[model samples]
Target: ALTTMAKWEGGRAVDARAAETGETPLMAAASAGQLDCCLSLLTAGADPLAVNVDGVGILALVASKVSQGKRSKVRAVVRLALLNAAPQLRVLLLHHEDCGRHISFKPHQESPERISAILAFIAKGATIGLFSAEELLVSTEFDQASKEHLIRCHSEEYISVITQLGEQVANTPVAFTPYYQGFKGLPQAKQKKAEFSDTFFSPGTMAAALRAAGGVVHAVESVLKGHSRTAFVCVRPPGHHAGVDGATAGAPSSGFSIVNNAMIGALHALEGNHGRLCKRVAVVDFDVHHGNGTEEIARAWHAKHRKAGARAASGADESDLFFASIHLADDGAASSIEFYPGTGTRDDLHHNIVNVCVPPMWIGAGAGGRGSVSA
Candidate 1:
């Protein structure tokens, strides 16, 4: 498979390091303690001496394995390799943090059990040294996303309204109110709580939401600018449900989501392109709930840029973006809120936006019965 991929990449991709971290496969294999595979790669002309931006080498990796415990068989292989290695190969083994990020806003999930689980997972992983401390960044340092970034994917009106509402709720305790008017199945008394309010807000809610959005923007920006190889933004009050302007399907916010983090990040990436705004990008969403808001934002951007001015004479903006979504289906009538914002139907496809709804049988209790995922 490696040979096939190398052939497909014309003999350069195998040795090509990650664009952000400059890590080669040998580094990964050694870090994971695949001794025999590392030896095989060394024999196959893989650069065992190659270092990442951090200057850690394969010998240093062997030291890490020794710290864990080394077997006689591997010791023999290492001895043979060292005997034949260049003078540069005998060097210090320094283990640097990998260019991957794990970010979260624990306060936003709203469920105490979920928060506990997240904390427990982090604590347990750290206790076992699953990853180094430097790599496990707590995202409190990032500022709230600026209005310029927010307005890229949302309306000024919506932003102003949401911000004022957040401030109001932050100052006083209030019950959750429906964001949209004429929301079905609500008593007149309950509907009078407030207008355009979806979920209960508190002093911490806006701060948490801003951090969540800012974290995603930072993650995407870092990866694109070659500062990090991968980043997992574990935020809550999830954004996929909210649409381009935060008012979609008659809901002020979709689900509990007020801001579309994915869309915000996507727009930032698009705007930061080095070219004449012609670089292509893809947004692949696999949330169990469909990312309708993200879809709306992507489609709008694609349509606006599909035909460009003289600046993009290369026509790079045309067919330059794609959005794919996979999620559970809406089984009821199209008009029903049980469909929950009612967007991700099978028929909703374009040259750019692709939506696939998993069949109902493949969804819950009957999931293992028969239907396939493609269904």
Candidate 2:
């Protein structure tokens, strides 16, 4: 393979497409599970982004083989192409065990389970030479978000309350219950019983929430500073449900959120103390339920910018932030079957806010899933 690759080093042999199928050497190697040949071809300059006659990408071809129980082979080829072939597209995947450690309702430990499963899959790929050790940048130790960072999106009072509650939960042992009645008697909980009703804290809740917020901040910094072109942050205590005052819109509780991580990361990028790292930022939320907290934050941020623009009389009407939330729409006239935190609607559309509501029982087929909606 080396001798042949050497001869085709400067030639188009590696990427030469089949006359009928339009498949390149790299695509063939990936389809046949030829890991060694795939690596050699990649090193010799095979374009992993090449598409076949059916317009199927090389990564898609590799992914299609996973159902055959060839996940290791698929990961090796995909990671090699992503990390090695495309130097300009350097990608980082960041996660930590602490992000998954949080109190949850009985028989519903989705946060920890999801994190463990994802990490296990990535670990399996790493063990099978999916990519070189140097290509994978996993940060096990990262700084926890400070109070200042948390205050960027959340109110100071809210932050103080959550921090105090987290500390109290850390020191005292609270009984686990499906309804979270165990925490109702806490002093802080009594202060805002409704807000903390749905959310529960554990000994590791503070650590996980801090890490989740901090990990996102770090990921943003790494991308903006050119250390990586993109990053995937996998942390729990999901932040979209959290708003400026813990819970926003009509949410009955914090919705299992401690800190608004996404908002914090965006604010840090746009207005961090170091300096303004970005002139414009966009947040796209894709979830079954609406990201009411993110929308609320974006709305407030835009309002602040509008006020600043008006006061300065600079006529700078353009916004520096854009937020889009695609979520399941509430069932009209079906009050009993309404979704959680149901708030997003078509009427919510603004210059910088876009709410794409997917109706219940809607099935998108083929390229129909790529349908677009005006902001």
Estimate TM-scores for all models. Answer: 0.61, 0.66
Q: Summarize candidate 2's per-residue lDDT along 1-375 as a digit string, tens digits.
A: 563773474756878999999998778777766666777776776765677999886655664545667676676656566566555344577888787677564445445887778878888886896746545667665678888888768877778766776777744323322223323343544344432345676788888999999999999998787676568788887889888876774565667777899989998888776776777888999998888888888877677767666522222233767888888766343334566786776434455887877766542332112114445
Instruction: Write down the lDDT of every candidate, Cα atoms only.
Output: 0.56, 0.70
lDDT of 1 by residue, 1-375 (tens): 444543444545446698787877666666556655555555555665577888766555543454435554454455345435433343111111110111222333343344446656876876886733333434434445677778867777767766776676535534334533233345666563454344555555555566667777777765555344356665655677766656465543466666887777777666643322226678888866667788777767666665553224334453666788877656454223344455566433444777777645424563312212222
Badly placed stretches (over 4 Å) of model 2 are 1-89, 125-135, 170-197, 310-318, 334-336, 347-351, 362-375
- Which stretch of 10 consecutive residues in model 1 shows the poorest summed lDDT? 93-102
The per-candidate count of clashes, in order, stands at: 4, 0
Clashing pairs in 2: none
Which candidate number has the best lDDT?
Answer: 2
lDDT of 1 at 336: 36
